[model samples]
Structures are given as C-alpha cells and as structure tokens.
Target: MAKYKIWVVAAATLLLLAGCTSLPGTSSSSSSKATKKLQTTGKVTDSMYEGVIDNGQYKTSQTRGLTTQQSNTSFDVKSLESGLLKLSKEQFPTSKYVFQEGQSLKTAQAQKWLARKSKTNTEGLNPEDNGQKDPNKRNPIYLQQILEQDYLGEDGSMKGMSIGLGMNQVDYYTKEQYGATFETKISKAMMTQQGKQMANKVLSRMRQKKGLSDTIIVIGLYKQAPKDSLVGGTFFAYGVSKKGSTTIDSWHELNQENQVLPVVNDEKAINQDDATAFNSFKTQVETFFPNLSGVTAQTHYEEGVLAGMNITVNTQFYSETEIMSFTQYIATAADKYLPRNIPLDISITSAEGMQAYVGRASGSKGFTTHVFGSY
Candidate 1:
C-alpha cells in the first residue's frame, strides 16, 4: 500500500475547529513610511484557510479528490504515538528517533510531527481559485505541484509542513488530557536580535530531546538585489527526500510548530549599517548550513513602512542548472537598471564571479551572487 495519501476537502471540517486563522500577508501593498497597513480585504492571505468546509462545494468540484479512509478527527495521545512512530520510521528511516527511557513519544516527538502536519493540512483549506487570478501572489511558485504529491501516510491523517524563521516566536497546535488548542507568538528579545528566534531554538531543543533531525528549506526575501544573484544571493529552498522524492516546501523547521509566515525584512526604515548587520547574520546561517542549494529572494513591497523593504533567505536543495538560470536573470536585470544603495527597492543583485555563494560556491567561468551578508 502507498505510505502516503491526500486527504479530501471533507476532512477539513471534520479535522479542525471552527475559528479564523490569521494567515501571513502576501500582498506587497503600498504604504508610507510613517503609516503601514496590510492588504486585508482581497484574498485570504497566509497558507491556512478560513471558515468551515463546504461539503456541497466539494462534491461538485472536479479538481480535488476524496479519499475514503482519511479521518479528520483530532488524534488522541495513544493514536498520536502510533502514527508518529510509523511516520518517523517511514519518512526518516536512517535517522531513527531514539526515545529516552520513561519519556512519552506522543507528548514530544509525536506532538511535534502532528503540529507540523496540522499546519500543512491547513493549506488544503484554501479555495483552489485563490492565486489562479494572480500567479505571482502564489507562495513557492513552481513548487505547488510538488506539494500535491502524496506526503501524508495512511490512517486518515495528513502531513503539514513545519518550518521556522530565526526569530523570537514559535507557533503550534497541541492537545493534552485537558483540551486542545493552537498557539502563536513573537519570540523573546534574548532569543535573537528580532523576529522568529524561538523557532530555531525550539528546533535545537527538539533535536537534542527527541533525536529529530531536520533538513531545512530556507527562504529569504529582500528589497534590493545584492552584489550577485546567481550562486550566492537569490533566496529559496527546495526539499529532496533521500528516497529520491522531491517536494516543494516552505522555509521552516519542525521544532517550531511549523508557523508558515513570510520573513519580510523592512529596509526603508533602517540604515545601511543595520541592513549590512542583518546581512552578516544571514551569512553566518548560510555558512553554517552549506547543504542549501540556493536561496530565492524577491523584492516585495511592505505596506505602512517607508516604501518598506521585505527580504527572505531560505534553505533547500536545487539543481545547479536552475540556480544558474536564476542567477543570470538577476545579473542581467541589475546591469540594465542599477538600483542605488539608498531608496533602492529591487529584486536580485549583480555577481562579481563565475560561481554562486550558497551552493558549491565553486565555478571559475560563471557569474556568482553572494548568498549571505550582502545588503
């Protein structure tokens, strides 16, 4: 039997409670420096869906399929343990999950996996036609088809993506003997400089406590292209399972409860020194995790900040050919219209060498972009 399967839309209503989930803001709305506001009215932003599932709509829809065995009900602690064991062993066989004596897998390892799965499952609730009108607004463009593939195991459960930004917050869902609830919040100041530091720290803690090994897919967006766009700087991450399975994924971590929010860096409000400081931190992350293929960065707008700047740096695997094409595109664009350091809100950067900074970082004859540390 297939290890993974897709759950139908009917599962949505049965699986989740009736509540509105605050999704990530994808629109690059125009906002002045002093006053910034998000584009709220249009399409429902963020990966999660709103309202209850429409059963009538599901039956009439030709696009989505209904899997009979899938169950949307919340899992109990016992079921969570069994399901997680099966999932962990099947999905990550090489890196076995080693449990400590007297520790409950459901409370720790299983809880982590389920929380991640719930986040991914929420993505299914979005009406299919959302981004059809505007393709550019779609998250992980060119990667959605991969997500359609089967990732969830059988036993009526779906798998969600768990990713975390290096900020101060951690978002997740859990149920104890008492009750079940979902949580999200910003990270503490001492955790990191700003943003979502709790995610990385939580993941680290999980790895040590539950023997969970993560293959991160990092995504970073920027207001302007760096010096190079090809090898080093373009920000995006892709996942390739060792079993040779490939999936389009977001830049997040499992330990962080898989909060799917775009990490938008505001550039207009900060000075060059501060921008460079952020870049330096990014460089450190890139250097630490050399396995990343390349990061895809888009020059998106931020409402309410000074013509605000938004940037992202992701971790994932990509073929060298794809990286080359992305890099060249950025370099060509930069050469045509050179955006100055200040008041510059552009995508990608110029390359000084023939290699990319993130991938192998080696190539003598091609132009390469700086992956991290260029602001």
Candidate 2:
C-alpha cells in the first residue's frame, strides 16, 4: 500500500510537470521519452523477474527470511552511553540524519560502497563456472562490524535491535530495473550515491509502517542478475537495534608449518589475507555479553575450514541505558573502513534480542553471510 502511494505521488509530480510543458515539436519527443522512462521506473516489476536460474535449475522465486539475537547483559547505561557517543562520532562524523526517521547519510554512503562497477562500457561477464571458490564471501565478523560502525552510536549504544529479513524474487529482471550504466568504470561515488537514494526510500517506507524508532535491523534479498549478467541488485538490508556483551572473533590459522599464519584458505589458491585486523575483533564484544562462552569461529577455505574459540565474560553492568550504549559500541566496532572517508557503518538493529541468526544467500556464483547471535 505504501509503495503504491509513493508511486502514485511520483507519477502525479511527473504529470504535473508534463502538463506545464509546451509539447508540439521536439518537446513532444523529449516529453514522450521522459514519460516512458518514468513509466519504466527503476524498480523491477513482477514480469521482469519471471525465469531465474538458481544453481542451474530453472525456477520461479520470491524472497523472504528472518535473523535476530536477544540477550541480557551487565553493562551500565552510563558506560554504554559513553561508548556509543564516542563510537558514533568516529564511525559517522557527518551522520546528522536521524537513522530511522529523517535524513540518512550513512545509508547513502554504504550503498555507494557496495554497488558494482565494470571496466568496459560494452564488456560483459560470463557466468564463470570455473568452480573456483567465491572471493566475495562475506565473513560473519565482517558483516557484524559493518553494523557496529555504520549503524550504532559511537559507544555502540542502542535501545533494542529490531531485525527483519525479507526476500523478493521476480521471474526475470533486466538492466532496466536499475538506471543508466556508463561504459568507463563508473566512480564509487556515483554508484554509492544512487544506492544510497534507493536504500533511503526503502527504509523510510519501513519507518512509516513500523513507526519512527532507531532500533530496527533488516536484511532482504532482491532479485539479482545472473553471474556475469547485468541486472538489478538485491541482497541484504540491515539496520541498528541494540548492544550487549557477546564474544565476536574472526581469525585464520593455517595448518601449514610456516612461521606466521600462512595467508591461505586451502590447498589451492593462496593470497588473500584471512587475518585482517577486523578478524581479531573479539574482546570488544565481550564487554557486552559477559556470560558468552563455548562459541567457535571458522572460515571455509580451499582446503577445508579453519576454526577458533573464545569465552566472553559479561564484564560490565546492565540496564536499559547500558544496553543501548553497548548496542552502539558493537555497531561501530563492526563497521567497514573506506580509506579516508568515515568508515561505512552497516545497520543490523533487528537482531538485537535474537539468540542466534545464521544463514546464507547465494546468487550469480556468489554468496553472502547472514548471521546474528546474542547471549
């Protein structure tokens, strides 16, 4: 219903402009073209995604799912607040827009950070079936960090994390679902800005239906083009929710007898470092979920899977204010750094109260992590 309303309003605005235009000559062609484009709308329609192939099998599809975490903690509200304030200022220095209601600058930045780009204007990617491991697999920790830094306050403060997972699969979608594509590699700024605009519209609608609250986390899957094929973008939707002490760690311990941890995932290709600084982020989460223990972390490498463990002690007092504070802190710590610009903080607000949320989304020979945990 809300989507319909937005479309209606947008159409009305366009029609009003058309009514004011003098359209008997070249103006007629221009107006007609503009109207056709507007009618096309950047949104993917049901008919656009009718025949998609998932893993080689032809099937019709729709997208939907849920992932969340909920827990009690001992962190004091003051500590949480102090932590969140600091974290927010660092993660989102220019983030003046309210996260859930008006203005969303962080969302704009994040979409810009993740949108894809091609080197050649007319180049195309073959659905490479090399059977090689996917380089884009998101580490569970990486996903978590994106949330802490991008969505929560500076100290990881959040009231309560409200997470929602949805999936939208059309039978067939085309490049028209999204806007224009330049031949030369488009700049990240351009893609991110476009992505930001889309993200804001979706989030604003969610806010209207659910009420104005900063405590919401969402991850959704939209129809994606085939691997190497140009189509619309669809994957995850996450927002901020809450923060508590929970042991979150990521590391790579190669079985090889090299001096330091060998930068390898398996017996095959070896180059990408599995031990990024973000991989060692564990103690930070423990500050929220003290009783967190017996948890294990692992990465599926070319050889097999590397595993590690940690026991996070609830090292702080807990309260409403404390929980909110902790929420913001964890969100910041989990954000992704984009060189000089303030790091892009990903929001996962809904998963705040969930016990554990873990899953995977695979498309175009690529896969992304969908994991959430609480104590």
Candidate 3:
C-alpha cells in the first residue's frame, strides 16, 4: 500500500473578490535595481524543504495520492514546492533551484496598491461582493515577489539559475455554483490565461536580474481558493537557456480518463450499497455523539471501482480526544463496509478549526489512517 502524507499549513483569513481582472504584462526592461527591490519586498519565508536530490532519480510518473488539505484561498504552495524541486532536479541536475515564496495581498489592500501605482480610479470595487453585475469583468489581484538563486560551478562561476514566482485568482462563487459545465470551463480557461501571463511576467523579471542571461527559471502558480476540494490550480516551468517553456498538467487533468465508466454490476445497486453503508455510519456517529450537527457522505467511482469517498461532519461540540476516537470508529466501519484500495477523506469542522483524516483499507479487514489539519 502506498503511504499518503497530509501536509497542512496555517489557514489565512479568506478574502473574497467580486470580479476578475486581466493580468497586466510585466516589463523585461526593469532595472536590476527594481529586481533587487522585488526580492526584498513582502514577507520572505525559508524554504519548507531544500537540498540536493540524494535519491539520484526523480519520480516523474509517480501517482500522487489524495490529500486532505483543500484549497482555501489559493493553490497549495507546499505541494508546489515539492513538485518543482523534483522537476528542477530532473530537468537541470547541475543547476541550483532557489524557491522564494510569495503571497497574495488582501483584496482591498491590493486594489488600493494598484490604484496608487497606476494612478487610476479603483473606487466602488469590493472583492467580497458576489453580486456583481458582470462576472467576466471582475479581476482579482495577485502580487508576486521575484528573486534569483544561482548555481555556482567549482571555479566560482555561475553555472545556472532558478527563480520562484507566484500568482492567484479568487473564485467569485462557491463550488456548487462552479459545478456547471459552462462555468467550470470558462473559469478554467480564464485561470489558465492568467497563469500564462503571470509566468511571462516572472520571465521578464528574471531577464532583468544581473548575470542571469543563461538560467533556468521555474515559475509556480499558487492555487486560489473558494473551492470544495483540495485539488486546485496548475504550474509551469521555463528554461531561459533553452528558450522553451512547458506547462505541467496537474493530477486532476491526468485523472480525467476515470471521470466516467460504463454501467457494470448495476450502477444504481452500487449507489444503494454505498448510501446504505454511509447512512448507517452516520446514524452511529449521531448516536454516539449527540453534539454532532450533521454527517454527510459523498462517494466517487472510476470504471466501476471505488475511487474516493468524502465525509463532512460538524464537530462543534467534541473534544480533541473524542474526535480522535470518533475518527477511529469511522475508519473501522469504513474498512468493514467500503471497498478496498480507495481513499476515504473525512473532514471535521468546528468553531476551533478543521481536522481531516485520510483512511485506506489495507490487509484483510485492516485500515490505515493519516490525520491532518490545524485542529
């Protein structure tokens, strides 16, 4: 069985945007002085994990398992960091990859900053308003920090370079509203364009950096939120020395083949089985803990095989120890009733915070659970 780890970061306050905006193109002629300012501005944090890839081989085709951390504001940067490190090692082994993390400014703050910089009227713009007249005209703001790290050769000469870039677009509506086919398609297309523009801006900035004429720049787009699931956004890589750029498709794209399957073993029968099992589990939870507000379960299948199961429970009144016990009970029940080899993600949200558990059935009647989230 593959061991899937859940990486959780502290949740920031969610800032809502009323509309989307066209991302502006960045100028490549900005002085090296400007590049230095870009590197110094914003809150700079140390790399979560950084070192040479001692494994000797990068896992390009490995399937990343499901995670419990959903996209709250933007794409998960921790996951992106992990992916970029692997890609840089594979594509530019001798080059040093420097990843400087960047964060999105609050909607109001960003609007004011943009208005002051451009000397334009940005009045009457509210990012938290979801009732905007035209959804297509709304543009969210993303502020990026640009920095370069050089890989030096034995003779103290610059061999190669890598730079980190970040951007985000706010989701105006909830996931339920985004479920419509047309809406999802339009949103994805717009985000993809925004991502491309942001990548170009990073490239332009990299060009301004001193002594980076021949370098490999890796650009990462953070996931923007107001989404239902953890799977959010995409990433891109550019080789300045090679004059080529490639957009790395995410796992969500790779799993598209499993979206639909032929009706075998009676689709309705399987749904009924899952519904019955889930209902029974919910009943047990409610019975054991009367304080639980509700329990909801949703199951997903691929080619008639159980692919995933999501359970959300309101844990407003449970203690930490009690929640842990409840999670174990649910895992044991899942192992008994649910199909094997599929992931089961349970989210327990309360006034304090959120706690998530990822459980997978193992040996005969055995289940393994990995817990995540701030709570």
Candidate 4:
C-alpha cells in the first residue's frame, strides 16, 4: 500500500592484496606509489569504470547518497552500478567520453520516481494503488529502483547517459495497513515489459529536464534477485536511444549470469563441468584441514563463458604458520581444479580477519599469493 522497501544486505568488495608473490610460491614484498595531488582527471579502470573530475576531485553518484541500503542488497547494487557502466561503453566509449554519476536526476526527482503511483503524485513510476486492501488484489511494485549515470565529453559537457532500472522479481508488501508481510512473485515476462515501458517514460521526463532529446541515452534493464538472495541480480538487456528520440530504438539482450558455489541445486547448475571443478577444490581443502569451516565460490559468466570467480575459504585456525600453509596449498589446488585463462580471487578468512589471499589476473600465466602481514 505504501512505498516501504527494506534491504538487509551490506558488504564491501573483497580486499585486493597489497603485497603478494607470483606463482611458484616465492615470497616478495611490494609497496604502493606515493599519494599524488588531486587533478582534473578522469581515469577509466580495466573493469570499464570511469570517474568524473570536478574541481580536481573525483565525484561519486548523487543518487547513491539516497540509498537506504535496507531496501536493496549490495550484490544487486554492485551489479547495477558496474554492469551499467560496462554496457554504456558500447555506445559511449571511454576513449571519447568520460563517466560521471547522474547529475540531471536529483535526489527529490529520483525519490518521486521510486514512490508508489497515486492520485496525489502521479509522477510515481510504480503502479497506482487500487483502493484494495488485499495483497493479492493489490498491484505489485514491479519497478523497485532506478539508477542514472552520465557520460561527459572531454570539454565537460554531457555527451550521453545510461539509465538502469532495477526490477523486482518478488514484491514484499502487507495485505492491509500495518498487516503481516507477504511476498508476491513477479514473472520475468511481466517484469521485463514493465521495465521497458518505464524506460520510455523515464526518457520522456529526462528529455524535458535538460533537452536530452538530442542526447544519446542507454537503458539497462536489470532483474533484481529476491529479497533474501545471497547474490545480486544480473542485467538481462540494454537499449540505446539515439539523439532526438525519447524512446529506445533498439534493444540488445545480455547473457551475463552468476552462480553461487556448493551447487545449491543440481537442476539449476550453470555448468556441470565448472561445478565439478569447484567441488574438487572444496574437497581438497576440506580433506587437508578438517577444522576449516567451509569453502564456497561465486562464478561470473559472460555469453555462457566463465569470466571470473571469487572464492571464500572460512577457517577456525588463527595461527600465522597454519594460514600461510593453507594459502599455499589452496593456490596449488586452485591451479589443478579451477578453470584456466580466467581471473580468480580467493580470500582465506576467519573470525580474526582475512588470513591470506590468492589471485590470478585474466590472461595471466599463474596465480599470485600474499600472506597477510608477511610483507
């Protein structure tokens, strides 16, 4: 009945080892460069991330400050933020255009767009309430959230924009005023349609705000996971709106997918071979050390091919020697069991903290290891 959203997930990305050793397990110490003065620069990362330069300082998203965090999972948030930039590059290449957080979409405007549609505020993107108190009869909020990113030319002018629509696969709501919470599953077909339609409407409004009718706009439709999902959602499709248009001219489908380790369900396995490899790696670690808690992994894929994997190894031991030994063993196990020619990062963590780290960059010959505090 109301725009009440809750998100119970919050986490930071895995730490990138500051010190490490290359394959063959030879230890080496490394130090980072000295801090440099801020400049009016826009640096793009290998992950397709581009930052803006405002008065010699990099700026973050304006809409990000408005996120409740309780209403969305960190996985979904990360995927949306990163995936949108990656997709937008197809149209707004980093070579010519720089990346900036959506500045045209203000906090109040985004809040209004995310609110439930009602007579008092028709600008709400979600469907208007039907005067019904029954949860089943009420219209579910298919559109959960909206994200905006801007593309800027070298001259600091707006070149293009990318908009991400976060569609909820499950709507959490109450049957009546202050009643018990109930969830309604939203089918993929309905969610996609609503997202596409919302994109058109959003374009119209954006054009009105800053004469964006003459600007190129990218739209990313993301299907968010359930409220209690461990992993975030994936972008299923994206579209481009050419200049002088407020609607998408063409849509392209994206086949990016992610899988949680331990093979939650055999029937839902993304790839049987990959699962076998992960299982073997897990078995090797457990067999060597029985006191360890568990080992799990998350696989990322693009166009049905394994692109990257982030593995987490939980343990109960706190000894530095034990951690170093375990890290060395896992690096070997990963080489034997994990897929080759793909980026992979393993975090060995315990109640104390992250004990050790192992990683392999894409196209790299071998993995790198770093025992925390050793360097």
Candidate 5:
C-alpha cells in the first residue's frame, strides 16, 4: 500500500477514460504542412497514442470506415492497430520515427482493392468468383480490411509506412439467397500464404502511386479471431520492403497469441504455466470477495513466453470506501500472484460503470491505482 501509487478521480457522474483513440480519416488524400513535432511517452502501453497538434483535431486516415470495415469483434480491431505498430517497431524504431494516421490510400481505391478482382473491377485484390455457390468451390475472403499507419521523421516527412491486413480466421456467409448462414474455416497456413501475396500486391499498388516510389513499407499479416471469440487474434508474419523497393525483401514469422484465463477445456493450446499463474491470481483476488460478480483475464504471449495480460473485475459498486479497500486488496494480490515482469491492466467495473483501474507497466516494480469516484 505504501509503494503502490494511487490516483483518485473525483468525478461525480462521468469518469473520463484517459486513452485517445485514433480518429477516423477522410476519404480524400489531403496533405498537411506545419511544424514537425514528435510524440513521446515513458513506456509503450496497450493504449499508446500519437501526440496531436490539438485535441479537437487530428490528422485523419485517408481511407474511411476504419471501424466498420472489419470484424464485429472489437478485439481484432484493436489488435489490427496495436499489432501492426508492435511489428513495425522492428523496422521503424520509436526512438526516431513519429506516429501518424496514414494519408496515402484513398477510400475509393481501398474499396476497389478490397472487392473481388472481376471483369468489371480489375483493381480488386481478391480472386475472381468461380461462379459456384459451393463452399469448397468458392474462395474464402482472406482480406477483411486494410490498415495504414504512417511514420514521419523529425521533419514531418513520410520516412516509413506500416500496413495491417485484417484477415479472416472464419468467414461467415450465407449458402443461398437469404438462407442459412455457413462458416468457411480459414487455416493459418492458407492465411499466411495469401497474406504474403496480398501484401506484395498492396506494395505494388502503392509504388504506382505518386511520391511513394522510394518509401519503406512494413506489412504485417494479422489473422483475426472469429466474431464470437473472447480474445483478439495475433500477427502471424511480417515483412519489410527495403528502401526504394516495391517488393518485400523477406518474410519473418511472428509468434503471438491471446488466451482467455481460467481455461475451460483441457484441449486449449495455451501455456499451462501462464494458466496456473492467472488462475492463482484470480483465486487470490476473488476468493474472499463473494460480492464480486466475476473475474476474467485475457493473457497475451510472444513466442510461447507470457508477455502481458488484460483483466476485468465485475462487481456492484455500493460505496467509495469499499472501492478503495477492494482496489488495494486486488493490487496486492496482483503483485504477489501475477507475473511481475510483464505489464497488466485490471479494470474494475459494475452495472453502473467503470469503478476503478489498476495497472503496472512492464519492467516496473509497482502498480498505479486509480479509483473513479463517479461510481
């Protein structure tokens, strides 16, 4: 309790959350010119944001429908943006590069490329339909949406670009006209191959555009989890187009995973050690608090090693004193039971709203606690 930092929010009704989400972009590709400034942070968290010139205005992504274009699950949508940034760090380090919403691809061209490549729409990146309604004969949509992130130098010029291709792990469609819906299970192997092919096509298309002939592009292949999944998907592979080149030099495999805590079945493909720690943490925190509704966690891993976790604690908040005490107890339990080396966020909620938040960054020894008095 002495070491843990506490931030008490005194709002009576509205507890404003801190993170700033990337704003939706316009359909037109318009450039902006101003003084170049870099956005810096102490540590990169799940909610890292670019420093904006003004809070009310942000540089818009050139393409529209960023939120509506992809899977229904918010997990993959966030995964698409954060996963691409994490993978892009290999090529574009944060020390020198500044983050910005992409301003190159237009919404019209993006829509055209996302469509199937048919006689009328030759610009489509997807394959032509085989004129068959059969699931086996019909090609599954490997590409769901395209995400672009621009990196600029200290001078505000585009030094590099990161692209995320939101691929489908399972394509849900109807067999007949307004008939029963069916699922087309997409394998990771097929996704990998198709993603690479599509990445190259995207690069080629970009190179054809003006002022992009010599830009460096990093592409990440993300396989989104099904809409019903509790956790988001991970990036499977990534590649870098060398400077002034349109094609990727080589593809590198990225092994990242997200597993829900308190694994229900023995058949799950997650780490048992992480499961044990997470379960133990859950038991330690919720064991005495019978009033707590439920505790769940989404564990993230990199190459089989436990990386970080996002946990949710549900309850009915009746008193602020109760919240303060409960938050401290959970923070203590988290410190003793959870992995101390990785970052973790614990969000306390109730039927009313978010009651409090507790978080610890990677490599940090203490947790920062926030109790929202609005509840």
Candidate 6:
C-alpha cells in the first residue's frame, strides 16, 4: 500500500550586496580609500501554516487507490514457485531479489536507486553537448534502472514483479509525439489488455512465495514521458488469496485517473472554509494597522488538517519597533481567532526591507517569536 505522510513545503531565496568595511574610529578619508567588496546580508523570512477551522462541512476524500488489501483462495503456490525456481536457474542466474511485506518502496532504497538512475540518465549531457537545452526535458530513466536490482532474485529468477501500468506504452508514445487527436484507440485497448496480462503473470509468481497465503501483494507502477525524469502517472495492482485456499480469487488494478474521493464529501466546502478563515485574519491585520498599504492572508493544509496560516503585509515605510509591534499584534489576534496547535507566519515588507515573525499558532504563548530580517 502507498504510505501516507505529511508533506511540507520549503522556500529559499538568495541575495547579494556590495559594501566597504570600516574600522571603529577610522578616519573618513581612510575608510573612503578602502576597496569595495561584496557582503552577505543577514535577513531571513520563514513562513508556516495553521490548521483549518473546524467546519463540519469540510472532509477529506480518499480518491487514490494506489494501495489495496485482499485475500485469495486456490492460489497455485507449487506452480508459481516452480516457475520462479526455473527462471532463477536458467533465465537469470546472477540476479538478486529482495522481498518485503509493504505497499510502498523502502525510502532509503528508493533514494539510492533514484540517485544512481539520475547520474546515469544525465551522463555526458552537458550544456555544450546540446543535451542540457532543457534540464527538465532530459531523457527518462528506464524502469529497470530503478527497480531491477530490488526485484532480482539471488537465484537469478525474479523475486517480485514491478510493472508500469495505465496507458499502453505505444499509445503513450504516440500521443506524446502526435497529440491525443491521433488514432490510438485500438492501440490503447491492446495496451490495457497487455497490462492486465503482465500483472497476472507477476501476481501468479509472487503467490508462490512461502508465506504470502493470506496477504496482499502490492505492485507499484510509475509512468514517465520518454525524455522526462518525473513520473507522470501512477498505478497499483494486487493479487488477493484467502487463507487455506489453493487458487487466487481477486485481481485489482488502480490507475490514477480512476481514483475517487471516497472520504471527502465536498472539496469546495473545505476551500470555502479556508477562504473564510483567511478573510477574517486579513481583516484583523488591516484593522490593527490602517496605514498598511496592502495585506493578504493564506492558509495551508496537510491531509485535511490545518498546518499553518501565513499573513503578509506591505507598507510604504516601517521601523524596527513598529515591525515588532505589528508582529506581536498579529500573533495575539491569531491566538484569539485561529486554532491553538498550528503555526503562524507573519511577514511585513516595506520600502526599506522586510521583517518576519515565525512562531506557534496560539500567538507567542508556548514558543518565542523568531524575528530576523534587514531593517
């Protein structure tokens, strides 16, 4: 099954400046005579989101079926195991296979595979060679490069099958080259059948393993463009067998397009809730600082939970003291109006520079405000 985890977004910026250093008590003339030099600016702006309001209308939807669980009966372990042993002994005598009882690929192993594939795919493709015309358009790495070693059995047969499902490869290639207007209906139909056939083959082989009687086998597939490293499509298929059964009973294929929001009742309701919260926060900031030129509030969510709330205010001018006070006022308002557990990120930008407040959502109650920026 696909692993569920919180997603965090990080943004970084770089600034450069030129200046001349002067020693304390140094004469103005001597200071002016010194050579100019580049200097680093000590300014930082951090932002975080607070949780969403507890609106009864808002709910999470489970649309993606990339993970599944099932049981099967009549699973032919003897036949499957025999095939695997034969394949190991004759087809691939020097391969290694790894078996694990999880839906998603192991994090560390996946990273190592991705790193190696990235290096190989980008090899010799430099700006001078015309291969770097577009970094994002570089040639796609083969699936084998990413999952081969992980699925190779020590005896040379396959340990687990990893297949890319969804649109047929031919139709995918055709559409990429000629757009969707081309006649690929027949090819697409053929491709779908092929995907099922391939899935069945892998499922049959995996069922033959010693201890997979009543468990689900999840095989993940990632579809990428011919020359792109990013996965554009994802799919999952499983073979289900029941305990004490000799044959497989169910087969499932989950494509990205077929996913449904099974848990979330209405996405629009959640969006409206976020908009309402942001407007309320924005109004409070404006009321506190009438002279503010412009102000905006944004809300962020993770797995349908309020993760952070961010507010940015712009003014014609600002002082260090004023910025600090403004941040404190906003923090206070956040604690009073927003949820207690999330974080609040407030930024104030003016003609001079910028300042920011990064702390807990419940104002500055439990955490100290970390304010840093140029004057």
Q: Is candidate 2 or candidate 4 better by lDDT?
A: 4
Which lDDT value does model 1 have at 19?
Answer: 25
Flag regions of model 5 displaced more than 4 Å: 1-56, 63-70
As a whole number from 0 to 100, the lDDT of residue 51 in candidate 5 is 34
TM values, all candidates = 0.18, 0.20, 0.42, 0.83, 0.85, 0.33
**What's each prediction's clash count?**
52, 88, 12, 4, 1, 27
Q: List the residue pairs that clash in candidate 5.
A: 25-61
Give the candidate order by descending lDDT. 4, 5, 3, 6, 1, 2
lDDT of 5 by residue, 289-310 (tens): 7788999887777778777778
| Per-model CA lDDT versus the true structure | 0.25, 0.24, 0.39, 0.70, 0.70, 0.34
Highest-TM-score candidate = 5
Greater-lDDT candidate between 1 and 4: 4
Error of 6 at 206 (Å): 22
What RMSD does each model have against the real structure? 23.3, 23.6, 14.0, 7.8, 6.8, 20.7
Q: Which stretches of candidate 3 lie over 4 Å from their true place?
A: 1-190, 210-215, 220-284, 287-289, 296-312, 316-325, 337-375
In terms of lDDT, the poorest run of 10 residues in model 2 is: 63-72
Deviation of model 5 at 186, angstroms: 2.4
Q: Score candidate 3 by lDDT.
A: 0.39
Top candidate (lDDT):
4
Q: Can you write out model 6's per-residue Cα lDDT over 49-72, one digit (the tens) per residue?
A: 110111221111111112111111
RMSD of 4: 7.8
Summarize candidate 3's per-residue lDDT along 1-375 as a digit string, tens digits: 011111211111000010001122211122133332221111111221122111232112111121221223233433343334433444454222222221122234333422212325433111223333344643343322222333433223344544433334443333345554212213445555655555564455445556554545555443432344433232333333334333223212211101111223454544555567666777777787777877765444433444455566777754567777777877766666555555455667777767546444323345555445425
Candidate 1 residues lying further than 4 Å off, grouped into runs, are 1-184, 190-333, 336-375
lDDT of 1 by residue, 2-59 (tens): 0100111112222222222323332222223321222111113221122112221111
Ranking by TM-score: 5, 4, 3, 6, 2, 1
- Locate the minimum summed-lDDT window of 10 residues in model 5: 1-10
